[model samples]
Target: MQVLVCGGTGCTSSASHQLREALRREIKARGLSSRVRVFKTGCFGFCKLGPLVVVYPGQILYCRVGVPDVREMVERHFAGGKVVERLLYREPATGEKKLRLHDVHFFQAQQRVALRHCGLINPEDVTEYIACGGYFALADVLLHQTPAQVIETVKKSGLRGRGGGGFPTGKKWEMAAAAPGAEKYVVCNADEGDPGAFMDRSILEGDPHSVLEAMAIAGYAIGAAEGYIYVRAEYPIAVERLERAIRQAREQGLLGRRLFNTGFDFDIDLRLGAGAFVCGEETALLRSATGQRGEPRPRPPYPAQCGLWGKPTLLNNVETYANVPAIISRGADWFASMGTENSKGTKVFSLAGKIMNTGLIEVPMGTTLRTIVFNIGGGIPHGRKFKAVQTGGPSGGCIPEAGLDTPVDYDSLRRIGSMMGSGGLIVMDESDCMVDIAKFYLQFSQDESCGQCTPCRVGVKRMTEILERITEGKGEMSDLDELADLAREVKDASLCGLGQTAPNPVLSTLQYFRDEYEAHIRDKRCPAGVCRALLDYVIDEEKCVSCGLCAKNCVARAINGEKKGRPYFIDRQKCLKCGVCAAHCPQEAIYTA
Candidate 1:
C-alpha cells in the first residue's frame, strides 16, 4: 500500500508535514515499513479539508487528517484491513461519504491537463516525473521534429496564454522566432501577484520539471539558447523546487549544450521578483529581471519584437508552459476537442471565498460560473444566497447571479465585462457588500499602479477616493457618473495591462449591483451591512431576553438596559458599530442593518 500526503504550501502550513512524520513513525511501529510506502506529493486540489491523505490501492481519500489520525490509519487501514470511514469526505448536500478523489464533487468536473502530474508525482524526484511521461515531449521535439513543426503543433492546439491576456501562444512564439535577431530569449512569467491566484505557484511546487522542459522546448522553437523564469521571491517552496528541477535537468544533460546530441543548446535561469504586482506584466517583468524598478513601459515594440536588453523574446506564464508537454505528446486534436469552439482546452482556477470547497479546479474553458461555484465548488457555505463571483482578481469583474449560466470563454467573459485574468475566481455571498467589494479592489489597484501614466496614477486614485466617500456615506449621485468616466479614461490611456484592467471590479460591480451603490449614496444604509460606517447595530425588541449580555459586551457602553426583563437599547451616537453586542448576545437578538 502507498500513502500520498499533500505537500503543497497550503497543506504544509496546516501541519501536513507533521502528519507525514507521524505516518512514517506509525508505519514503522506497526512493522509495515517494508510493505507500506509513503510519499509527499503536491496539492490534492481539495484544500478546504486539508491536509489530505490518499491511501492506495484503496484510494480512500481522507480529509482534515491530523498527526494523531496517522497511527490509526496505518494500523487499521494498513494492518487491520479496515477503512477509516470517519475521515472520508462527506458530501455537502447529500451527507454521504466519498472515499476516492474523483468521487468528490470538488474534482468531478476538473479535466487536469496542465495539472496532470501535479498531485500524483513527487516533484523532487526526476525519475517519478519521467515515469509519468514528463520530458518525453521535449525529447520528441528535439529528435523527431523541427522548430517550425513544433510551433505549428502548438498553433493547432489552440493554446492561448493562460496568464491574463489569452493571446495565442503559437503566434507569440512565431513572432519571436521570425524577429531579426540571432540573440533571442524565452521567458516564463512566474511572478504571480494576483490576489487569490495560485495556479502558477502550485504548478511550480507540484511539477517544476514540466515548466523546465516546456521552456527548453520553447527555446528550441524560438531559436533561443537561454530562458529565464521570473518568479516571486515570496514563493520559497516553488523556488526551491524549481531550482532542484533545473539542476536535475542540467545533470541529466537535458539542458545546457547539445541536448540529445542534436546540436540544440538550451538552458534556464531563475530571476526573482520583489512581489510587485505590476511586475506580472511582460515589459515590467523584464525590467525587474534586469535589476530595474518594476514598472510598465509603453509598448509599440512588444516583447516578441524587442525584449530583454533589446533582443527578441518569447514570454509565456508558468501555466502556459505547463501545457506544452501535454500538447506535444497527446496531439493537438485531443486538447482542442475538449473546450468551446474558440476557447479550447481547460483552465485552472483558484476557487476561493464563501464556497464550501475552496481549492484549485481545472474546468473546460467554457464551463459556466454556476458549474464552477455550485457543482464543482460544492455551492455556497451555510445556505447563504450566492451574490456574485469575482473572477480575474482586481483586474477582472464581478459576475452576478444573473450571469451565472454564461459560458466562461474569453469572448463570453469579455462580452460580460470580464476577462480570464489569471483564473482567480472569488465567490461572494449575500453578506458581501458589492460597493465595499468594488472599493477594496480599487484601493489595491491604485496602490499597485506604477505611476508611469497619468490615467492610472491620478485617475485610479480619484476613482478610489470617490469609492471611499461612497462607502463612508458622503457620496453624491453624480459621483457614479464621475467614476464611470474616470474608469474609461484610465483604461484607454494606461501604459500597460495593470493600469488598463485596474477599474474592472469597480465597473463590474456598478453594472451588476447598482442598487447597492444607490443604497449607500441615497439611503445612507449598507444593504449588505458590510460597510462599517453605514451600519447600525441594534438589539431586537422581540428576540432580546434582557440578559444584559449586549450591555456587558459593549465596550462603548452604548447598549442601555439597566433593568432586567426589558429590551436592550443601543445609543446610535455612542455605538461603535463593532458588533461586540451581536457576537456576545446569548439570545442572538442583536442585528445589523
Candidate 2:
C-alpha cells in the first residue's frame, strides 16, 4: 500500500509536513513500514479540503486528513483494508462520500493537459517523473526527429501560445530557427504578474520536470543550445522546486551535454526577476535576462529576430511550455480535438471571488461560463445573485450575468471585448458595484504600469483619476465619454500588451453595467452601496429596542440615547460611517443608504 500525502505549497502551509511525518511514524509503529510506502506528492487540486491523502492501487482519497488520522489510516485501511469513512469528501448536496478525485464535481469537467502530472507524481523525485513518462518526448525528439520536423509537428497541433497572446507556437520556433544567427536562446516566461493568477506557479511547483522537458524540446526545435527560465523572485517555492528539478535533470543526463545519446545539447539556467510586472513582456524579459534594465523596445526586431544578447530567441510562458510534451506524445489531432475550431485544448483558470469553490481549474476551451460557474464552481456563495465574471485579470474585462451562456474560447471572449488573458477568472456577486470594480482594476493597472511609454504612464493616470472621481460620486456625465476616448488612445499608443489592455475593466464595465455608473453620477448614489462616501447610516426607529448595543459599539460616540429604555438616535455629524454600530446592533436597527 502506497500512501501519497499532498506536498504542494497550499498543503505545506496547512502543516502537511507534520501529517507526512505522522504517517511515516504510524507505519513504523505498526510494523507496516515494509508493506506501506508513504510518500509526499504535489497538489491534488481539491484544495478546498486539503491536506489530501490518497492511497494508491485502491486510490482511496481522504480529504482534510491531519496528523491524528495517520494512525487510523495505517492500521485500519492499510492493515485491515477498511476505508476511513469520516475523512472522505462528502458531497455538499447529496451527502455522499466522494472517494476518487474524478468523482467530485469540482474536477468532473476538468481535462488536465498542461497540469497532466501535477497531482500525480512526486516533483522532487526524478525517478517518479521518469516512471510517469516525463522525458520520453525529449528522448523521442532527440533520437528520431529533425528540428524542422519537430517544428512542423507543433504547427500541426494548432497550439497557440497560452501566455495571453494567442500566437502560434510553431511559427515562433520556426522564426527563431530560420533567423540568421549562430547563437540562439529559448526563454520560459514564468514571471506571471497578473493578480489572482497562480497557474504557472502551481505547474512549476507540482511538475517542474514537465517544464524542463518542454524547454529542452523548445531548444531543440528552435536551434537554441541554452535556455533561461525568468521566474519571479516572489514565487520562492516554485523557484526552489525548479532549481532542484534542474539540478536533478543535469545529474541524470537529461539537461547537460549529449542528452539521450543524440548529441543534441541543451541546458537551462534560472534567472530571478525583481518582481517587476513589466518584465512579463517579452522584450522587457529579454532585457532583464541580459543584465540590463527591464524595458520594452520596438518590435519587427521582435524576440524571434533579436533577443537575449542580440541573437534569435523563442519565448513562451509556463503554461504554453507545459503543453509541449503532451502535444508531442499525444499527437496534434488529439489536442486539437478538445477545444474549439481556433482555440485548441484545455485552459487553466484560477477561479476566485464570490464562487463557492475558489481554486484552480482546467476546463475545455468551449465550456460555457454557465457550466463553469453554476455546474463546476458550485454557484455563488450566500445565495447571492450572479453579477459578473472577470477574466484575464487586470488585462481582461468583466463578463456580465447576461452573457453566462456564452462559450469560453479565445475568439468568443475577444469578440465580446474581453481577451483570455492568462486565465484569471474572478466571479462577482450582485453586491459588487461595477464602477467600484472598474476603479479597482484601473488602480491595479496604474500601480503595476512600468511607466515606460508616455501613453500608459499618462493615459492610465487620467483614466484612473476619472474612475476614482466616479466611484467617489464626484463624477460628471462628460467623464464617461472622456473615459472611452482615453481607453482607445491608450490601446492604440501603448508599446506592450500591459498598457494596451489596461482599460479593459473600464470598457467592459461601461459596456455591461452602465446603469451603475449613471446612478453614481446622476443621483450621487452608489447603487450597490459599496462606495462609502456616497452612503449614509441611519437608525430604523421601529426595529430599535434601545438595547444600547449600537450605542456601546459606536467608537465615535455617534449614537446618543437613554441606556436600555429610551429611543436611540444617531448623530450624523459625529458618525464616521464605520458600520460598527450597524454590525453590532442586536435588533438590526441600523441601515446604510
Candidate 3:
C-alpha cells in the first residue's frame, strides 16, 4: 500500500508538507512504514480540493486533507484495511462519494499528455521516471533516429506551440537546423507571468525531467549542443525540482555529454527571469536570457534564423516542450488522431475565477467551451450564470455565452475575437462587469508593457485612461468610437507581440458587452454594481426595521436616523458608497443601483 501526497505549490502553501510528515510518523509508529510507504509527488491538478492525498491499490483519492486526519487515515485505512469514508471525494452534483481518482468529475474529462507524469511519479527520482517510460524517447531519438527524421516525426504529429502564438514546433526546429550556425541554442520559455496561470510552473514542479529530455531531443533535431530554460525566480518549488532533475539526469547520463555512445553531446542550463510579463515573448526572452534588458526586437529576423548572440535558435514554452516527449514516444499518428485537423493533440489549461472546480486541466484541442465550463469545470458557483470566459491572459479576448459552444482551437478562438493564449481560462459570471473586466486587463497590459515603442507605450496608456473614464461614468459617446479606433491603430503599429495583442481585451469586450459600457456612460450606472464610483447605495424603505446598527456602523456617518425610533436612510451628500451600512444592516435593506 503506497500513499502519495501533493507537494505542488498550492498544496505546499496549505501545509501539505506537515500532512506528509504526519502520515509518515503514523505509518512508522504502526510498523507499517515498509508496507505503506509515503511519497511526495507533483500536483494532481485539482487545486480547489488540495492538499490532495491518494492511497494506491484502490486509488482512493482524499480531498482537502489536513494534518489532523493523518493518524485516522493510517489507523483506519493502512492498518485496519478500511477506507476513510468522510475524506473521500464526494461528487458535487450527486453527493455520491468517489473512492478513486478516475471516478471524480474533474478527472474524467481531462486527458493528460503534457501532465502525464505530473501526479504519478516522484519527480526528483529518475528511476521512477524511467519506470514510467521517461527517457526511452530520448534514447530512441539519440540511438535510432536521425536529426531530420526526428523533425519529420514532430511535424507529422501536428504539435503547435502551447504558448500564445501557437506556432508550429517542428517547423521551428527545422528552421534552426537549416540555419547556418554550429552553436544554435534551444530555449524553453518558462516565464509564466499570466495572472491565474500556473500550467507551466506546475509542469516544471511535477515533471522537470520531461522538459529536460525533450530539450535533448530538440537539441538533436536542431543540431544545438546547449539549451536554456528561462524560468522566473518566483517559482522556487519548480526551480528546486528542476535543479534536482538536472542533477539526477546528468548523474544517470541522460543529460550532459555523450548518450548511448551515440557521440552526440547536449546539455541544459537555467536562466532566471525577473518576473517581466513581456519576457514570455520569444524575442524578449532571448534578450533576457543573453544578459540584456528583457525587451523584444523586430521580427522577420525571427529567433529561428537569428537569435542568442546572432546564432540560430529555437524557442518554445514549457507546456509546448512537455508535449514533445509524448509525441516522440507514442508516435506522431497517435497524437494527430486526438483533436481537429488544424489543432491536433490536447491542451493544458489553468481553470480559474467564478467556476465550481478551479484547477489545472488538459483536454483535446477542439473540445467545446460548454463541455469545459459545465461538464468538466462543474459550472459557475453560487448558482450564478456564466457570462464569459477570458482565454489567453491579458492579451486574450473575452468570449460571451453565445459562443460557449465554439471549439477551443487556435483558429476557432481567434475567429471569436480571442486566441489560445498560454491556456489561461478565466471564467466570469454575470456578476462581473465587462467594462470593468476590460479595464482590468488593459491595466495589466499597460503596467507590463516594455515601453520599447511608442504605439504600445502610448496607445495602451491612452486606452486605459479612456476605460477609466467610462467606468467612472464620465465617458462621452464619442469616446467609444475613439477607443475602438485606437485599439486598431495600436494593434497594427506595435513593435512586438506584447504591443500587438494588448488591445484584444478592449476590442472583445466592446464587441460583446457594449450595452454595459453604454449604461455606465449614459445612465451613470454600473450594471453589475462593480464600479464603486458609479454605484449609489440606497436603503429599501419597506425592509428597514429602524435598527441603529446601520447608522452606528457607518464610518462616514451617512445613515441619518434616531436609534430604534425611525427607519434609517442614507444621506446621498454624505454617503461615500463604501457599502459599510449595507453590510451592517440586519434587515438586508441596503442595495446598490
**Per-candidate alpha-carbon RMSD to the true structure:** 1.1, 1.5, 1.0
Q: What is the TM-score of each candidate against the true structure?
A: 0.98, 0.97, 0.99
Alpha-carbon local distance difference test for all models? 0.91, 0.89, 0.92
**lDDT against true structure, model 3:** 0.92
lDDT of 1 by residue, 229-320 (tens): 99999999999999999999999988899998889999999999989899999999999999989887878799999899889999999999
lDDT of 3 by residue, 1-593 (tens): 98999999999999999999999888899899789998889999999999999999988999999999988898899999999999998878789999999999889988999999988898879899999999899999988999999999999999999998888888888989999978999999999998989999999999999999999999999899999999999999999999999989989998888887788888899999999999998899999998999999888898999998888999999998999989999999999999999999999999999999999999999999999999999999898888999999898999999999999999999998999999999999989999999999989989999999999999999999999999888999999999999999999999988889999999999999999989989999898989999998988888998878988888887888877677778888888888888888888999997
Kindly report which residue stretches of model 3 are placed more than 4 angstroms away from their true locations once superposed: none
Give the candidate number with the greatest lDDT.
Answer: 3
Clash list (residue pairs), candidate 2:
none
Residue 516 displacement in candidate 1 (angstroms): 1.1
Backbone clashes, each candidate:
0, 0, 0
Candidate 3 differs from the real structure by a C-alpha RMSD in angstroms, to one decimal, of 1.0
Clashing pairs in 3: none
> Which candidate order results from sorting by lDDT in descending order?
3, 1, 2
Model 3 error, position 163 (Å) = 0.4
